[model samples]
Target chain A: MASKEKVAIIGSGLIGQSWAMIFVSAGYRVQMYDNQPEKVITAIKSIVDQLNNLESKKLLRGNLSASEQAALISGATTMSEVLQDVFWVQECVFEDVALKQKVFKHIDSMLKCDPILCSSTSFIPPSQFMGHIRHRSSALVNHPVNPPYFAPLTELVPSPWTKPEIVSRAKAILTEVGQKPIVVKKEVPGFIINRIQDAIFAEAYRLIEDDVVSVEDLDAVMSEGLGMRYAFTGPWETAHLNANGMTEYFEKYAQGIFDVQSTFKPVKKMEGPTAEKIIEAMNKKVPMETLNERRKWRDEMMIKLSQIKKSSQ
Target chain B: MASKEKVAIIGSGLIGQSWAMIFVSAGYRVQMYDNQPEKVITAIKSIVDQLNNLESKKLLRGNLSASEQAALISGATTMSEVLQDVFWVQECVFEDVALKQKVFKHIDSMLKCDPILCSSTSFIPPSQFMGHIRHRSSALVNHPVNPPYFAPLTELVPSPWTKPEIVSRAKAILTEVGQKPIVVKKEVPGFIINRIQDAIFAEAYRLIEDDVVSVEDLDAVMSEGLGMRYAFTGPWETAHLNANGMTEYFEKYAQGIFDVQSTFKPVKKMEGPTAEKIIEAMNKKVPMETLNERRKWRDEMMIKLSQIKKSSQ
Candidate 1:
């Protein structure tokens, strides 16, 4: 049934290719497009390679084989051709606001049917670009983390003008493609994930700045300590277990928590001596020159974790 | 060899039993003691069961098999008997400050040589109880996360009076036991892990209270999104990859980060409506009656994650 539905992925970047794979994995006919056709061709090749890799690892999302999923993806010569009969559109262009606004405006004029217009913007909210679009009611942000196959979260943040049913449709589509979608009711800068990340980074920076712990020690505290629990559960659930339950947890530690939180230093800009010091330390473990190697290592771990999560369930 | 060393673990609760398991796995003789001899016997039983379980999962640390590790652990009726000829001691008592002070004073007076008096206190800093101890120089906080066998990170936090050599020795012992030990140079409340945990929890509470996202959706952002990378890398390494490098990351997004961080609401007491609301949501997923079920699920995931980490490397 999903094979009868058509979706278009604009920009043909890493995110676009990943989205194409996701849609195709769910048996959707995916039309890939880029302003420069050469980029789209490159995306197609990378998508095939990625699908083959996912297949070898047995981490592919759907029942379809790699080649079968690859067969459902096709490159579009023109933007109009990409939007021809698509039920949904995923725009993965550059992060610049003006560029997104221009491309979205163009797509809005070209769009015939009211398909869910989703932007793969991690930081930018939909309100930044959807104001001038004709189909503004359908526009929203469907942000996916990097390596979306392993990190399957999709944050669904709709603009003020976005229709409620459109958000629901986007959520259902993402879920259908094996992506976990979290709805951000109102538009917030950084949305949910980045907000939580920045919160952690803020405290991490403070720890380093105050010399409470070294960079290596700080990371170890997470990867070996907190990250172990977080891999399977979240903060609230962790709190629930740490004490008898959430209510008991508050009864025992709320005052102490408030006291500790009060001492948390003000957020500093992520520059100056502190930032340089952290960069220096990070370089020692995963040097800037060998980042890609480290990233490949990270992705391999993620794949294994995905498999572990599946089997444990 | 580490096999020649003997360690005493006072108060044979879960943490003490776990510490004994860690020490025994490293080929050390562990003498477990508790106020009630029955609790010590129960701990010995639980340790055997846990070691057997770890062996079944192929997660038993060190070169020892399940029964071999179990043989290295024994229950002691008397505190002096537990401490006799021991090279180190891990005091795992109730979190009450006065009770800890009394225990430390007793342990301090009973010390034959200067065995490292490592307290397994998570929140109470060593200073709170170590000031009056005769062998205060050897005292510090060697805090371990729950289920220390799988989540092997230990925070080595030294009191102001603690000798530098004691810190190094405690770190070495923890390392020998296959634990990832990170130094907390200065004593701070909540140490490193809890401080970071509280920071995350503070923001999580605010997000929930403000209704930015539902409890379930907020957790999905971590378990599915940020956690995927965090399971392998820390925040600093994550920042390094999100942009060109750490320096480039700061150059690009530091200001925006400061802006968002500034907007973070003030820390409030974690009680009243917010706490109840979170409990309500958490109970829906993991009911209070089934906490043991949820905790088992968490531990199983942790074991699998540990396996994945080892295999990925």
Candidate 2:
């Protein structure tokens, strides 16, 4: 009634629940649909519970209480029902391409009008799901981070056929909410975040395999050296800020980067004394027995950090 | 006069000043030393000023205010003068291996009655400088992050011949001074942080070279995507939390990582078309004309982030 945007989330899994949290927190009237009615209900309640946790931690920005937070929930029973009134539908179902084909066929049949339908798949190509759809021009991927109540990055990946108008509208809506969304001009496996994460993980794995440093030592490099800078800036910006400017840093050190990159051999599977050392280190630092407890700690820390950002701003 | 530990910081450069802030903040009397008498005078005033700035930002976690903070600064004209009766020495000077060799030779000669001696060299390995020293067993690398006053990670790298007691002592002192230190059992170039940073950078650089993503989009992936998550959890811990457990997660996906690793080709140096694109993106985002102002912004943000970590803890 207040000109609020309507959002439909398909597949109420962990990522779906996070999407629900993000859309709800960003002031969208969210309708989460799952084939199983129970999952949608669970996702909604779980999202609400996460909101309450944020409230309790004083991490939710802007002084909204748990009771005040409950008003954003709106539910749906079917994909048809979700597409009935929504301006956007984000598909977060499993990553199986065949299953996506089946689901997209069904959604395509129901999508009589264009409403910027987007997939939330992390690894799958957008071509798989959108290629066969009748309204393929409106479909794309809008991958989001997990536990979206704390993390605030969203990737707006568009298929080639996706209309520029639709992207602009989606980008506007995302900005109106609090999340930072960056449009990926082309779709690729792992989108942007996962791609970057995967690249770093490969070398980190190789470093351990080479017995260059322990896992904890590797983490320290991030948490202390690069992580400290990265949490505030990106690699390009870091290069830019480190010296006379990024261009100069590049000019001075481009050859150095090439040499380092050249030496990087593909990592084989984790093996030998290294994997055992990592497992031992992890068990000592964060035991399997206390994983749930540690996860809780992590969530709490994330909540507090988000709160810090929200309040400071 | 109190029962607190005494630590000496040799060389009054940016790294030395940062170490002083860290030591003072962690409740230690910092004896700051520089070869040049003028540098000692400049460093004391500069560090005191920085402490005042930290106080203004509510970032300083130490017990001392700006005025009394000056009392903690014991700037000595010589390394031997500052190392007198101290429990440990953290040397920060020129990064040249030759300079480090000459300086460490002097430091080892001074000896300071068997105090743990460490260098803040970012690149040079500890063994290269420590092998010839009489007090070699007591020497290792205790490399603190640039501006450790704000960023709390310290890497404690020990050479093969280094004594365990010296490692423990350095680690303990680093901890006592509120640094998050990760011990490197094996030393490698760029160590842990730079290696990972270098790898990600190489990949990102290639993306630009391949004409896949613009510089802004590349940075956006981190600033918005995985970076937001990384601000909360390290990669290893992230793996641990993503699945039921770390070991299970690694066991299942180590092969995928190996596969991805196999696909990675070392990046060529940035030249030709991509360089122009990056220069365009960077010039748009940050005008080179305002670099000094931007540096201020970077330092301010670091201070705020550091303060946030302090407050949360």
Candidate 3:
């Protein structure tokens, strides 16, 4: 553990703080950088709160004392200082195009060694910021699921210009740090995860927009039915193991899938009737009077489920 | 346990056997009917093996002895015999349209009371078979995940003609049997699970079909990345809880989702080049050389995962 690599996290909001907690727990010396000194000063406290929550729930894998947690974090005054001598830099700055462009370009300019510079932006591609840069080889998008402190699903989306060696390095580092890092070989608009999410929301919006079912029913369809299976087997594996194998599954049902595909008509921006439908149903399910309480219930369920999953492992 | 219900399972193939195992383990009397005398004679033995496997794996919530298991199964030779005093009837016939039509019609005609008549058919809806029948109000689809002995996901899709009371009854019975069921308010093609699955597959096909990434990387993206998060949270809850609150989440990122949705193109059918891409990629990732071995691994994983999930409850 003394040979732990140094990791840098740029940004001090929820995403960056979460990264700090995870890296520290995974036995990495984490260097955190944020423009606001106040948030940086309290980052260790925030990390402690998260770790305590994990401990109370018996979800903390990397046993760490409060002082030990503090020892791993070094909040730097400058981004350049944070990147200095670190093996990897995970940038969780703002998701704005120009902001990422300015911040990443500066980090790229100051890099003496090309440590993997991964952006935490969910939507934009790496090429959006790294495209015309000099040391763009090390810059790529490494999007993590929100509250990635508990959920370890992290996507390493490499741009077309991203070097294969950098991708491998990023994958190996993330694996070492208790994160499930899957690579998106090609950078689609939202990458693979969000692309699949968009596909799901299209149906959800369409169903609610068309008045086919309630929002609660739509959620239950997944949570009770498909979501449970999905927790273990993916869509492909589910199909492959359904009847015969995947081949026989396609042979019997490919035409059926295409026929269903033909019927899918995506709803427009959830602004007017679609938004009203969701809000109306949500109001009924979780009224504005008790929305805050309902939100806590949701998060608690997520935490409990997270705890259950950890025990399973 | 003494007030437990009875569910008649007609047809003793894989689906039927799975149902028998599910019902018996959930403290229900199961009358299994198959035209083949050999199948009816051996259905109890096979179900015992399945239950024993589940018991050893810690997936069975309730235990039944061999004598008790045999007592739970009151084998019936004909449809009328099986349905004599059954509270629910789940038909898992072959996938022929004509055969399903004929069998469903007879079953609907013989159903004396308003007990639920649920079919485990995938593509075909209740309307296709029971639209003109006398007991159409009690008939609907209750499609379960394959090997329902383990995976408990069931889609309780209702036809337009189906009565509310029947749907409620089916849902309650499903719950007692320890199978998770979601009601599809409308009988849409592909139902809820498969429709969303097709949408994801369509985009995934386009992604791979367009050479965005190879098959293995894409599968890894779901298996290791997004699918892990989805195991715990639905898309709506995910969006709502990702940020501090739901409003902040939607206000922050709905535009990005909308932007991606706006540019999504329609997918071509899986034929020719598109089909070739998937086959080539799947072959490369999960070669036919180790297909049998991989299947064993998947089953073992399913056993472990199901055991873990059941224990947490």
Query: Considering every candidate listed, which one attains the maximal DockQ?
Result: 1
> lDDT by residue for model 3 over B75-166, one digit each (tens)?
88787888787788888889777887888778777776666888889778778887877778888899886656555668888888888888
Among these predictions, the greatest lDDT belongs to 1
Per-residue CA lDDT of model 3 for A160-213, tens digit only, reads 788899889888878877777877777778877788788888888887777766
Q: Rank the candidates by DockQ, best first.
A: 1, 2, 3
The order of the candidates by lDDT, greatest first, is: 1, 2, 3
DockQ of each: 0.77, 0.52, 0.41
Number of residue pairs clashing in candidate 1, backbone atoms closer than 3 angstroms, sequence gap of 3 or more or interchain? 0
**What TM-score does the predicted chain A of each candidate obtain versus native chain A?**
0.96, 0.90, 0.90
Query: Lowest summed-lDDT stretch of 10 residues in model 1 chain B?
Result: B1-10
lDDT of model 3, residue A28? 84
How would you encode candidate 2's per-residue C-alpha lDDT over A1-313 as one tens digit per residue?
A: 3536678888988888777666666566778889999888877788788778767766664334555555767678978888776788888898788988888888889875668887877667788778887888888888776655556677788788888888888887776677777777776556667768878887777777777777877766665556656665688877777667877877877775666667777556775577777777777777888988877765665555455445544
Cα-based lDDT at residue A11, candidate 1? 91
What does candidate 2's lDDT look like per residue over B141-252, in tens digits?
Answer: 8877655665677788898879997788777777766787878778777666556777888778767776667788788777655665565567777777777777887887
What's the best-to-worst order under TM-score? 1, 2, 3
lDDT, candidate 1, A146-246, per-residue tens: 87867888899999999999888888888888899999988877888889999999999999998999998898887888888887778888888767788
After superposition, the stretches of candidate 3 with alpha carbons farther than 4 Å from their true spots are: A1-3, A63-69, A280-313, B1-5, B63-70, B109-114, B273-277, B280-313
Candidate 1: list runs displaced more than 4 Å.
none
**Candidate-wise lDDT, in order:** 0.86, 0.74, 0.73
